[model samples]
Target: MIDTAASLSRFKRKTPRRVIWKRQGLAFLFLAPGLILFLLMIWYPTVQTVLFSFQNVGLTGSKGWVGLNNFDRMFGDPQFIIAWRNSIVFVLLSLIMGLAVPIVLALMINEMRRFASVFQLIVYLPALIPSAVGLLIWRLIYQPEQTGILNSMLKLVGLPPQLWLSDPNLAKPLIIVIMTWLSAGGSTLIYLSALREIPVEFLEAAELDGFSPFQRVWYVVLPLISSRIQIMLVLQIIIVAQVFTEPFILTQGGPASATMTPVLEIYNAAFVNSDFGLASAWSVSMLVVLSIFSVIYVWLRREDTGMN
Candidate 1:
């Protein structure tokens, strides 16, 4: 009887160890593909970019080590300065237009008692469409010709057709508008999801305290959703700073380079200009600048995770 009891205890211990080993093996099997892709697609390129930024990488291959010269050139270039200025402007405009639209829409949508799903579908439709198609649609609407939609409206008012994308002053703002329209839908859904998670009693409590509707939103709702807003603000800055598609498809950084951005400049340096060395330098510079915002975003999310 004693021997049998000892055998049973040993079997129990060994069974749990085998089960744990099997679970770990399964976990690693599921993780292996993602790890391989990350190393190949993301990590490898990043390492190459860092290495190439310091060296003189020609079209064929690396020429030699030329430390700090690329950085100096990037700083000295006139177009690069314009690119940075434009990137800053993009961030500012996105904060004003891109960031607020979603929050406002989410707030309005949250108050709905009926047909909310219909409104959500309508709002999110723009995002569901391909970004290229959305930009192209705007391109047609903003066409500088008299036959174009906006120009046709102007013609009806006995006004001359204005150069929309070709006007240096108008180019950046117009592109920003397109970006806002395209992005607002997706962002609204995010904020709406956050709004839905708020407890009902909180709003009721605010009303009982005799807070007005505006006060309820401003004080109660905004405070509750501030975490989402904070994280989105950083993300918006990061996205706008590296804006490529809007300018690339619509203006191609034209209208006297009014819509020129850092990413666009990097692209032009690599392919259009055939100067891979300069392109790598530009990429590194953008990485450094944008990494500040990235770190802020990560830290904010980490705080959120910890709170949860």
Candidate 2:
């Protein structure tokens, strides 16, 4: 009887231990699919990109190992420099001027007591428009002739028919404007969500303290939503830096490569020039730059929070 009791106790303890191990095993099994997909899609490509950056690769074959020559070549190319400058300008414009509009618009929408859904729908409509269709519509409007929609409107106002996308001086800024218009709605939607998450008690307290509507928003709402705004700013910077389709379809990096961006340069290097190795090198550089930008944005945002 003593032996039976001891054996039963041991079995009970062992059973629970086995069950815990089984549960942990099942959890990892469930997670494996997602982990595998992430590694295959994200990690593998990154490793491949870094490797290809070093080799003297083309569409044909590996000519030889070119250590830093591809990067050196990039530095010497004036067009690459131009593209890099334009990319920086694009990132700055999108973050500062482009990002602010959405935040302001979202706040305005939140203040409305009626027709809120209508306002949201209208604000989001621009983002829903297909990119190709949007680009085509803007292309026609940006046409250099008086027959163009914008030039005709300018003529009505007694202003000169401007070469919106043709002139080197105006093309990049014009592209930036188009990007801002199309993308503002997405940012507004994000800010709207963040604004909604703010505690109503906070606003009420501000109101009772003799704070005006503007003051409440400026002091209370803005600070609370700052984190979301920072996240969106980083995302916008990354997207704008890699801007391709709009410029490729609309400008083709034309009028002396004025609106050319890094991604455009990468495409030209790989496909047009058939220098896949050099293209990969440029892509690697872009990745490094993007990673740095992301880190800085995160650090600055953390500092903002720490200050508050």
Candidate 3:
């Protein structure tokens, strides 16, 4: 009996299983198209960008490799320093003002019964406007030298006319406001969807228990949509950090480089100076910063869920 068992085990080990190969081969076939495109478009370019970050390659010819030289230049450049400062300030202010406003608007809209579609449309229509059109409209509104609507209003209210975009001090803050107005609609929609998914029975139960409107929202609604809030916070941070278009169109990073963001600096490096290597270095730095935030956001979210 022992010999027969050993012989059977040996035969099983030696036999070629067509089933295993067929299953694996089918899986590979299903995955091959997407995998090939990802390798070519994303992975390959990312590897090349990393390599370029370390080199001093020129447009016309190959230059000698200079490890970390571009990074050194980036640190020393006064413009780059200004860009870093502006990026931080812009993102901070936007997060404080723009980020929270959308949540509030979404909550209010969720509670509304009359003309819900109109309210949603009014909030979201700005997002659908072409960037160029929005830029032009805001440019007219923020026109300097008391020519804009805001300054005219100030004049009407018996106040001094203020420079909305021309002054370095006011330019960054004004940009933050514009960004908040234009960008918050998308977030509002996301929050609204989350709010809709919440069980109405739970809210009704809270109401039956003598919960006031504000109390119900505070304890029940907020807790239910906490995940959506977390996601929006991270996404807003990502978008605000990489802001370029508003600064470009509105301030041009000017009135003393008060609006120069990291992305703008990278654009100037690559296109204006035609320094692909240095641009790649700057790009890598921005990507690293974003990755750090992403990891922290994920870890914190997990911890928050675990505690809950």
Candidate number achieving the greatest lDDT relative to the actual structure: 1
lDDT of 1 at 214: 98
Estimate, for each residue in 202-296, the C-alpha lDDT of model 1 and write its tens digit. 99999999999999999999999998999999999988898999999999999888999989988988888777788999999898998899989
Model 1 clash pairs are: none
Please, what are the lDDT tens digits per residue for candidate 3 over residues 82-179?
Answer: 88778889878987888788779888898789977688889998887776678879989987776678889888999998877888888888888888
In candidate 1, where is summed lDDT lowest over 10 consecutive residues?
A: 299-308
Which sections of candidate 3 miss by over 4 Å? 1-30, 297-308
lDDT of 2 at 129: 87
TM-score of each: 0.89, 0.87, 0.85
Model 3 lowest lDDT segment of ten: 299-308
Q: Model 2, 183-288: lDDT tens per residue?
A: 8888888889888888889999999999999999899999998778767877888889999988898899888888888899999999999998889888998999
How much is 212 displaced in model 2, in angstroms? 2.5
Clashes of 2: 0
Off by over 4 Å in 2: 1-25, 60-64, 296-308
Residue 128 accuracy (lDDT) in model 1: 79
